[model samples]
Target: MDYLLSIIIFFPALASIFIFMMDNNVAKPYGITISLIEFILVMVLWMGFDYSNPNMQFENTFALITTYGINYHIGIDGISLFLLILNAFIIFLGTIYLNQPNDKNHLVVCLLLLESILMGVFSSLNMVLFYIFWEISLIPILYMIGAWGTGEKIYAALKFFLYTFTSSVIMFIGILYFAYLFFITTGKWSFDVLDWYTLTLPFDIQIWLFLAFFVSIAVKIPIFPFHTWLPHAYGDAPTLGSVILSAVLLKMGTYALIRFSLPFFPDASFALVVPIAILALFMVIYGGMLAFAQTDMKQVIAYSSISHMGVAVIGTFALNLEGLGGSIFTMFGHGIISGALFMLVGMIYHRKKTRQISEFGGLAQIMPKYATMFGIVMMANVGLPLTIGFIGEFFSLLGFFKSHPILTLLAGTSIILSAIYMLILYKKVFLGSIQNIKNLTLKDLCPREMTVMISFVVVIIFFGIYPKPILIPIQNSTQQLLQIMNDRAIKENTKIHLQNSLNKQKTALDTLHIQKLLKEVQYA
Candidate 1:
């Protein structure tokens, strides 16, 4: 297990160098092989991982800067274990299932580089190491969108970069400030995150620190108002670009919320729960409404992401075991569902050369194989029972409903809205009369496409029915986190924030002093 996580993180980067040297003809297969090996190694990691143990595993540490306490520390706990596997599997699938033509090996190398950075982001324990990976991951995707994307690719790429990178500078400052705080408290210079978890700042500091981190995470998740960059990026990127962006990249946000935000500022999180929940609810409704109104299929999926990810936000802010666990589960669920849907859309666009829902009429009649598989994925997208999406959303809403019934009810409305919008989109694209004469002549799924598409279909349904494999591991990790937050909250009297917030009560002393002045005057 020693250095295994390092190999997983760096193998793609090393292979990308080889891929860069290879002739164009040989690069794709070699890239696919590297990714598959990476995926298999992660599967091995999963098999060996003890779901019963909630602590970080596969610990690997090497000092890079002894004076500043920057160590190359990396590990995985139950939460990151499954994400590691998902990232590897999706990158493998993204490489194999791509339907584009290429003349140079740049795209291949970039994708591999992107995968390595993502692996580091998920598994890195040290904030400096994590920040390095996080910042570098932006470059590969930036190249992908601008070079290989569609209309206004430059605009989309820049928007995506500027939105995320600029916000992250503030986050980087927060990390350094926290490190400085830790060094002040205990005369040791360390950038370890586990050490910061023990520091309890005043309520006011938590609010400002929480906002600093929130800007970065929100832009990534593209939550509500911060989500303007998403549709343009998703709509402009190529198929595999869209797949990785939607499936994996977006998850980094919700994952950060769980990993850093809550524990770092438990009291502030509790105090702001209602306002944040309202914002999440707004994301759910507003994102879904936009999805319903889209004419382009890619835009539909892009907007739906905003709506879907809001559930994860709701679950997280619920501040309970179920809420935290379910929020993490939703991250996995959204990744799978969004990845498959983007693949299917890519397949459609490959054959039709168009992404408009209006351009895809009678797909069910013309390409039954494609239609059937597509239908199954869309059902999962709509959160139908016996599908992966349903269980995650169910648990998320179920968990949060206990804390704020009204807000949970509002957030849960996305199901009906999503079902209506998604199903309507499906019915329009797949079930209508043959709107275009060329549809009748279109070929169905080829051997390569079926192998890829059907495998994803199986994953969605199998995990949907038997979610325990993933759920239990996620729960194990989340429960440990929940225990920490709970123990801290008890000693800090955290629940008072929630009660005061709800009752509209103020704990601060009156500043106006009108009544005090009158009493003083009367006494005089």
Candidate 2:
């Protein structure tokens, strides 16, 4: 337990507390050292991880309520493996790459504590435990934004918190109801997801639970209509907060879809797949249109995240190996691509004191290295051939093509739309006459900045050309997830039983079962 999942989850908080006790000058380096240590430990997890095996690994359990068969459980599977690594690695680079005007101790602590809670979200195997981590993760980001953010910071913080928290309350209700369903069928209570995956619930209940969970994921991913909070949150947050939000936090929604929604309610998932795809198609078009219309660099990038995530959602709900595999890959690739973009934007803002596209021009000549790095990362963002972004989008659209050809065509338009906006952004921001006289003296990327951007480029190119390492580990798990949906579609026996159970009258106590469970958890 000392060196396994618990350490990966708790190490950041431990270091954060210690960092708080240190001198202000010492806190940054101390946080960086601990972050690197955490990164190495994740590498160890990866090295020890049997990539050939798709089952959950390094499982650790602690009893929370043995009488109810609920416990604190955490584990990792192939799908979550590299993401865990990405979370640790990006935060490491973030700590070092940080040149924020302020060197406040509380900011560093907030970032590290965020790392710990995010790790908890990715690792938890129990429903209530996962929900707890999910809820807690929002607090650090709120602190970072409200205390350190710029324009509309408090409003953005509240919007982000309220949008996600309100949606999550729905998900929590779904989870509790799911556990209650288990009790009626099995004569006991349990919140273990692995155990719930084995239960068969009514199709009627699946639809309710599916919508409940979908509302939550949609808000987090901010699919189309639910995306109102993103631009504000991303535009108003600090660089590090924006970076983590783009890189890791958004993926939690898609990851949860794969982890909870697909497995737990296969019939309802299959039933709703098309409508979801249509919504995703709208997301791609709408997000791209908004991005194309933006004059501010950060707003464009923020909206672009919405567009790329639309592709990820399409891939995931394809419910095939290619679709699911591509979705996982997209999460990692988008994190890198978007994270690098935000970092570069931060660098520019640091020097220019502006994020306005109109203010920039002729940076390629002034800052040759930074401009070149921007070209490379932007190309990857546009899904250039032999880049990490291409592999994910290609496979996702390909997977979607099998099941929904027409919708896939509409979704694929994002490819051209993304290029148009991104290239236009490049021309506006990096090419043309030097508009501002003061910009002439602007310095190029320094040594530390190059380390971060160059590292991002190397990974993007190497993996873009050869995605075998990423694809192979996820195939077995993705295939298993696909099978669960297929099985639910054909299993008449369970379906019939579930149908029969739904016909029974709801009791007064049945309505209170949820309330009773809520109280138990409140004092548990």
Candidate 3:
């Protein structure tokens, strides 16, 4: 299975060259065919996955840089498996939806390359390999925005690149520092993630190292203060670009928090939990308020993403199984619901040539099917019952409540606020008297677009009704993480206790020796 994971990760990349060479007339069909094959291969991997095991599956390693202690290692756990499937699913559907045979051949080629790098990021077991994939993945997106985006694409792409790139550089240094520490302790040089787990750093070192990693993941998650670039990126990117960014790319950050941050710095994580939760709380409330202030439908969803990610991150820092599970689950839900919402927004933009909510009204009267689908998706975005959105939000809030009941209650405002903004956006666009004459004759979704959206709707509804499949695997993964945290904590406490005992014994021995010397002097 070592090569199996590599094949899945790299095949699309190899296929991308062929895709790039193809004439425009055959590009769409060719892209779709390759993507279908890639997606099916992911399904095959899923069917053969050993659900009972929490350890990395299909593990493989290759010597890439022995001098630098870097190796090309790859594997998947339950947490990553579903995400890989999600990536494949979204890209495949996105290809079908992007059926512009005569246009944007280069864009299709870039997305294929992006898909391959993303798979590598999710599946890589070695820390350095993961970092390499992580950095490489950014190139296509930067190019996508600069080459294919609109309304200040260059500015948006440059900003996106600088923000994420700076963080990745910092994280690389942190990784190297930690790997060096591992070598010093055990006389072995390895950049394997599993090995790093056993190389515990002192408290002060952990704090600084954790910050280095945190900055990178937080920027990726784009939590609150760090989220300035996302709105522009989302708003400027093409429909397909926005969908891929929302559905798959953003998850990279949140997923990193779970995969690397929590395990590597458990004590620091435990200590910073309260402050981080507060930040999340603020992001949830503030981002929703800003969403309501937006006239551009795309910007509304953009701000809403910041708010949703806040909930996801807070759940992650809860450091408990339920919270951690909910964080991962919410990320999954956000990928589907938000991705669909972006697509819907793009559909509106393509038809009306504007994203202003005021440009639409009484769409239900003209386009019933489109209106109905938008309403359902809007409801999910608001975290209404019986939707995938509800599962992640409910569990995340519940997890926060365990430790910070008051913060949990305050953070709960996102649910209400999101509903308010989303519903208002929905009402303005789809209901009320027909304000714009242009909307009266707007075309409804084509079969291809409708099929793509309906597929997402089906996934959201399926998970909402029965999340057991997702929950079981996430639970196993989180349980193992918790065990490692507990073990680390216990060892630290034991070390402190033993040090104190040794100091006490040394003091007592000195006192007894002094008394014996005094008695001998008295006898002399």
The numbered model that scores best in lDDT is: 2
- Candidate 1 Cα outliers beyond 4 Å, as residue runs: 490-524
As a whole number from 0 to 100, the lDDT of residue 265 in candidate 1 is 82
Q: Which pairs of residues have clashing backbones in candidate 3?
A: none
TM-score for each predicted model, relative to the true structure: 0.93, 0.93, 0.92
Model 2 per-residue lDDT tens digits across residues 395-468: 78876887789999999989999999999999987898887888989999999999999989998998887666
Q: Give the per-residue lDDT digits (tens) of candidate 3, residues 1-524.
A: 54778888998889888866777777777778888999999998988888778778888888988976788888888889888988888889888888443555777788789889999999887898899899988888888788778899999988999999998899999998998898889998899988877767777777889889989988888886888999889989888888888889999998888888877877777778888888888789989999999999999998898898899988887676557778988988999998889888888787888998877889888888788888988888888777899878877776678778888888889899999999898888888889988778898888888898899899988887767678767766776776666555434643343244234334632334423432443235
Clashes of each: 0, 0, 0
lDDT of 1 by residue, 324-367 (tens): 76788788888988999999888888888899888778788889
Model 2 segments more than 4 A misplaced: 1-3, 490-524
